[model samples]
Structure formats: structure tokens, C-alpha cells
Target: MSHILEWKTRLYLFEEDGTTKARATLDTGTTTLTGHGAAHRNPADTDVPEIGDELAAGRALRDLGSQLLDIAERDVESVGARSGERTDPVLGWSL
Candidate 1:
């Protein structure tokens, strides 16, 4: 069977007091998840806004991905199946 679903994601970034912050949101029709991250630049380092943005955004996305995996694991356990029973080739690790 083929399933067609649409999920929406939005990422917002901002800087304050030499710190860059990022918030990422994912909407999966039935549930919504959010992740947050921050990056602080050293005073002695070059003040690069783009670098800060990249660091914060990457961290936020990583957090969001972890949350997604947690939810999937819980869902599998809810159905009386053990989570991480098998390894996924793409992920190269057990779920």
C-alpha cells in the first residue's frame, strides 16, 4: 500500500546578546513537536552572524529528529511490539 501524507515544518532563528537561538516545529497532522537550540559566540572570536545561525539551526533540527524517534518508539510499544527489536539499514542502528 502507498500512503500519501503531508507534514509541515518551520524553523525560526534570532539573535540576542551575542547568542543565536533557533526554534523548529513539526506538525504531523495528529501531533505537533517543537525543538529549541542556542549558540553563543565567544568574545574573542569573529562575530559571524551566518555561522551562529547555522550552528543554532543545526542543533534545533537535531533535537527535533530525536523527538521524532522517541515518539515512533513509544507508538510501537503501545501496540505490544518491542521498540528497537530490529536494526534499520538506513539508520544503521536499532530503533
Candidate 2:
């Protein structure tokens, strides 16, 4: 048997000057994680657009990784409970 889960997350990025730079949407489905990047350029600084894209995309991916780890930890706990094994929330699985 296989377990499948889907989660949606959005990240908003702002420039150092307090201006909106980019927005990212992350779709984590089953066994895949996908991201969409959008840029809001500031005519004053062309570099800001690229920076925004990088930050937004990176942040979205980091968030996805956190979610995946959380799911794995929960699954480990479930298995350990069924087998009368003790699992440490901090150190993870124990045999």
C-alpha cells in the first residue's frame, strides 16, 4: 500500500527597499514538487528582478523540503507504534 498527500504553499518576497519583488506558488503532490516563479520588476533597478526570482524560488523549495520531512517523521512514528518500537522525536527512528 502507498500513501499520497498533496499540499499547496505560497511565498511572497519583498525587496530590501520594502517593495514587492516576486511571488512563488509551490504545489507538492504525491511524489513530486513543482514551483511557479513570478517577477515584479522595479524600473529603478533591473537587478532587483533577478534577485527577487532567486529568493522567492529558493524560499519556496525550502518550505517544500520542510513539509516532506514532517510527513516522513510522522510515517516513521506510525510504523514504530504498530511494532511496539520506541521512536525518538529528536533523534528519529530507533531499532
Candidate 3:
């Protein structure tokens, strides 16, 4: 069966003192996760707010993606456990 679901996300960016910070949040009704990122500009370099915003936002998204993957991996790891069976420290068979 095909399933359709929606996840709402909000991203906020802040800049001050040549530094940009980003926060990304995802809410799935029952669960909420947040990712954070920051970027700093060197005094020698030109102040580019857009570049900082992009970098910080990208990092936050990457963090969020990693969190989701970790959750999925943990969920998958549990599928191998059965009654009175211990979960394997290493997932799947080592080839």
C-alpha cells in the first residue's frame, strides 16, 4: 500500500557581528526535532550576509538529515529482535 504523509519544518536564521546562525525544526505531530548551525565571516573577507545565511542553513539541514537517518537506523535495528533474543551489536551479517 502507498502511504502519503506530511512533515512541517520551520527554519530561522539570525545574523549579528559577522556571524550567522540557523535553527531548523521539524514537527511530525507526535515528534519534534531541531538542528542548529552557525557561520562566521573573517574580518579580511567581505561581509556577505547571503552567503552566511546559505552556509548556516545548509549545515542545519544536514544536521536534520543525519538525525532522521539515525532514527531510521535505530528503528531498523530493532526489527531483528525477537522474544528472548538479544539485539546484535552489529547490524546484518558481516560478509
List the RMSD of every prediction in angstroms: 3.1, 8.0, 5.7
Better of 2 and 3 by TM-score: 3
Error of 2 at 66 (Å): 0.3
Q: Stretches of candidate 2 above 4 Å error? A: 1-47, 81-95
**Candidates in descending TM-score order:** 1, 3, 2
Arrange candidates, best lDDT first.
1, 3, 2
Clashing pairs in 2: none
lDDT at 52, model 3:
99
| Candidate 1 vs 3: which has more lDDT | 1
Q: Could you estimate the TM-score for every candidate?
A: 0.86, 0.43, 0.82
lDDT (tens digit, per residue) of candidate 3 on 1-95? 99888999999999999999999999987889999999999989998899999999999988987898667666656886322223334455321
Full-model lDDT, candidate 2: 0.56
Root-mean-square deviation of Cα positions for candidate 3 versus the true structure, in angstroms: 5.7
Model 3 is weakest, by summed lDDT over 10 consecutive residues, at 81-90
The candidate scoring highest on TM-score is: 1
Which of the predicted structures, 1 or 2, would earn the higher TM-score when compared with the native? 1
lDDT agreement with native, every candidate: 0.87, 0.56, 0.83
After superposing candidate 1, which stretches have Cα over 4 Å from the reference?
85-94
Better of 1 and 3 by TM-score: 1
